[model samples]
Target: MGRETNCTEAADTLQRLREVPIEALVPVIDRSDPGRLGAWQPVIDGDFVREYGSLSVKNGDYPKLSLIIGTTSDEGASFSKLGLNTTEQIFDYPVKQILTAKIL
Candidate 1:
C-alpha cells in the first residue's frame, strides 16, 4: 500500500510501519490444528517477514526482521493470458511446498 509519493513523505510513513511491532499477535498459534485450540489466529513468521517490508522497498531501510518470503503459482498472469484462473492451477505447488517444508 505504500507507493512512493510526490513528496516521498508517504514512503517514509510505510517504512516506519514496517518497523512497527507485530500487532497483538500470537504467531505460534493456529486454530487450524487440534480443533480444540479454538479460533486463535496462528502467528506465522511469514506475516512478520512480508507485512509491509517488501511493499516499502523504495527508500526504506529493510528492517532486520526475520521473514519468510515466497511466492506460489497462484498468481494471475499464468491464467490471465487464457482468461481463466482458479485454485486448481495452484494445487500442485501448494501441495508440494507443504510436503517439502515439512522435512526441511
Candidate 2:
C-alpha cells in the first residue's frame, strides 16, 4: 500500500482503539503482524509527552536529574529486517516511525 494510505489507516485504527477496553487490546495486539504492528511508541500528548525526546533534551525541557540509558541484549533483534542494507533505508526507518507516531 502507498505510504499515505497506510498512515491514514494507522491513524484511523488508533482512533478506534481509544474506545476499546484495555483488556480487548491484548487479542488485537496478538493477532497483528509482528513487524507491521502500528507504532508502539509513546503518544506526544501535550500534557505528558510535550515534544520529541531529542527536542526535549536539547531544550532542557525535562527535570534536571541523573539519566540512565540502557537496553536489553536482544532488543535490536526485534526490529531487524533482511532488506534494509542501504544507509538510506536504515535512516529512513526511524523517520517513518516518527511520522507514524505524529499521525496518531
Candidate 3:
C-alpha cells in the first residue's frame, strides 16, 4: 500500500539522519524546519542549555549578566485568528471559550 511505502521511506530517512553528526545535521534541520516544529528538536547539551529554561534560571546555571527581554505589542497577534480588525472582535474571540469547553 501507499502508506507502507511512505512509512518505509520515512524509516530510511530517519536512519540516515541518525547516522549523521549533530553538528552537520543542525543546519539541515534549521533549513528544513524553519518553524522548528518538526521531528528534530533542541537538546540541553549541558554547556549552553543545561536544562529546561526555567529550571536553569532558577538553579542559577544561566548567565548572571544583565539581560533584557521584551516583545512587541503585536507579538501575540501572530498566533491569533485572522480578520481580528476591531478591539471588540479581539476581546470577544472564542479562544477562551474554546479552551474552557475543552477543559470541561
Predicted model with the maximum lDDT: 2
Q: What digit string (tens of lDDT, one per residue) describes model 2 on residues 22-81?
A: 676655554445575345667799987889999998998888878877876534533666
lDDT of 1 by residue, 20-82 (tens): 445412232211233333243344356565444445576474666779688865434333333
Candidate ordering by TM-score (highest first)? 2, 3, 1
Per-residue lDDT tens digits of candidate 3, residues 1-104?
21322334565765665666667754554345334342444578787656887887788876787886887655454455666645688887775667678989
lDDT of each: 0.45, 0.62, 0.58
Task: Give the RMSD in angstroms, all C-alphas superposed, for model 2.
Answer: 14.0
lDDT of 3: 0.58
Score every model by TM-score. Answer: 0.20, 0.41, 0.31
Shift of residue 68 alpha carbon in model 1, Å:
3.8
Please rank every candidate by lDDT, starting with the best: 2, 3, 1
RMSD of each: 17.3, 14.0, 10.7
Stretches of candidate 3 off by over 4 Å are 1-48, 75-88, 91-104
Q: Tell me the spans in candidate 2 whose CA falls farther than 4 Å from its real position.
A: 1-31, 35-38, 69-73, 82-104
